[model samples]
Target: MPAQALGLPLLPPSKAKGKDFRRGVNMAITGGTAMNFSFYKSLGIENLVWNHGSLDTQIQWFKELLPSICGREQSCKGYVRKSLFMFGAYGGNDYNVQLLERGLTPEQAMNYTPKIVGAIANGVVKLIALGAVHVVVPGIFPTGCLPIFLPLFGDGDADLDDAGCLKAYNLLPPDQVPQLDAPEAGGSPPAEAPQLDEAHVRGLLRPRVPDGPGAPQVWV
Candidate 1:
């Protein structure tokens, strides 16, 4: 989700709708799909930081955007605080962590489900306190239907359900987990248990930055 990647096809603001928002030479045009590009044009995002990492790493990425939230004067561009925060589709990595790293059974990972939900909830609360007026938390997808889980957890055709997915692995839809806490803000889920005022650091969030500047931080 880099700025150049988004803006290039989006046609800046001027080229898309005949209204120029800034003064600059147009680089490329994406044909007559201008109307569909409206949302990206109006987003007015200055920077975008993205990477393939677990939920914890995503949180750190959010913090990296923190300084820009308040603007560092002559140093950094200013982005309003608490404007809109989008996080997650997490817990996928939780499964990966348990199966790949922890060597825990699916049931054991399921048992740890509550903590995972709690961490998400805590992250939401923390973001709100930090400066997020609106937070968007998306639910995880059904791993049972995914190709990865079918072979890893399934046992031949007997394990396949109506959709040819693994029934043994899919206890409940991944989206049905306890978290879906805040439906108001784009269906972001919450934690299972009440988290301490800490940043709800557990699972992935805990291992990376357990100590130092934001040590033992819990969001809500």
Candidate 2:
């Protein structure tokens, strides 16, 4: 079963929480909630790469220079080289790609999101075939509640889960940028939560990115 489907907690109490540890390294997977961190640790992870915004930025940079990066690694003659097993929740920005650039309606961006999803799936499959073991793939959190999303939609009904972020707003139509960026123009107060528009709610359900740079090309 999928991790989420199996009903796993995002984070659990660590056995090392209260104990004094003088000589051990703890690899924390930071950006993530307690869910996968504890779960993966229980499965034997001592060092974490801190998978928060820092890692996300890394992934984004790599995606932008994918060809150069893949080539450099492949051509390198390293004494201890191993197949790079890369996995991530990629292509979550399709709606933004479509809405922001293509001038697609929020509804239209919804229709166009699956294209992005497929590309990410294909990339993952190729990585697996390349002999990657112990792969961990996580999906994007709700797009609607991103600081960009909440102020724009202003949907009070919207709520953030344990991660203090909404996974729902991420799905809004491409034109939703104004909604996502609405708080920026406001005089003050970072919008903690806002009511999402019908378009915003509808847009969050689907995911897609098209050819020619897709999500990575934007804001570049």
Candidate 3:
């Protein structure tokens, strides 16, 4: 469904001033990563990172805007509590940077999944600390089904699954997949805040796929 359909219109970019954020704000940037460029620098691949707008950077932007969004600490807490926070489907670009730019195989890229997930979890914890009561942190989509990966990673007929996706890359590692659902920062979410995952997102996007050859497939 469209953001407006859910009553959450597309958030304006951080730089968009004089606009109302009574709905929300968007800090995401194209080519952003879950892990910062410094992390990539540690791996000796920082040169491949074209955009420095990592999750941390976006969070900082939110922090800078928080005071203006809600004045007093107590009022800000209430504003944050009532608002829904949508964290991410984050790790995609983190892996993309490595797979497409640094030339790593899917399996090799999987090695960073844990760290990437940790970073997202940490971001959620930060949101909760800032008084978020309803935060939805979504998982990455099935990578193999993505159009970009299909052409670049497919090697032979055997690599394609019955559904026509690259079989090996269709799913995340079982252990890594559940880590996103585990307690945030080692504790359960606030009692008022229900834990949510990607399933909720899939349900929203699934119904919007039109039936036709030209219809765009919704990947969640």
Best by lDDT: 3
* C-alpha lDDT of all candidate models, in order: 0.44, 0.37, 0.66
lDDT tens string, model 3, 184-217? 2233322232223333232322232234653333
Kindly list the per-residue Cα lDDT of model 2 for residues 1-220, writing each as its tens digit.
3636887423321223553322211222334321223433453544454224233343333333333323444442221023233244444444444444455555665554333433333343333333333234455545655676555544454455555554444444233233332222212212332233322222321122222431111110
lDDT of 3 at 53: 85
Single out the weakest 10-residue window by summed lDDT for candidate 3.
Answer: 188-197
How badly does each model clash, as a count of residue pairs?
16, 34, 0
Report clash pairs, candidate 3: none
- The candidate, 1 or 2, that scores higher on TM-score is 1
User: Model 3: runs farther than 4 Å from truth?
Assistant: 48-50, 173-220
Report the Cα lDDT for candidate 2: 0.37
Regions more than 4 Å wrong, model 2:
1-86, 103-106, 155-220
Once superposed on the true structure, which residue ranges of model 1 sit more than 4 Å away at CA? 1-54, 68-82, 172-220
Error of 2 at 30 (Å): 18
- Model 3: lDDT to the true structure: 0.66
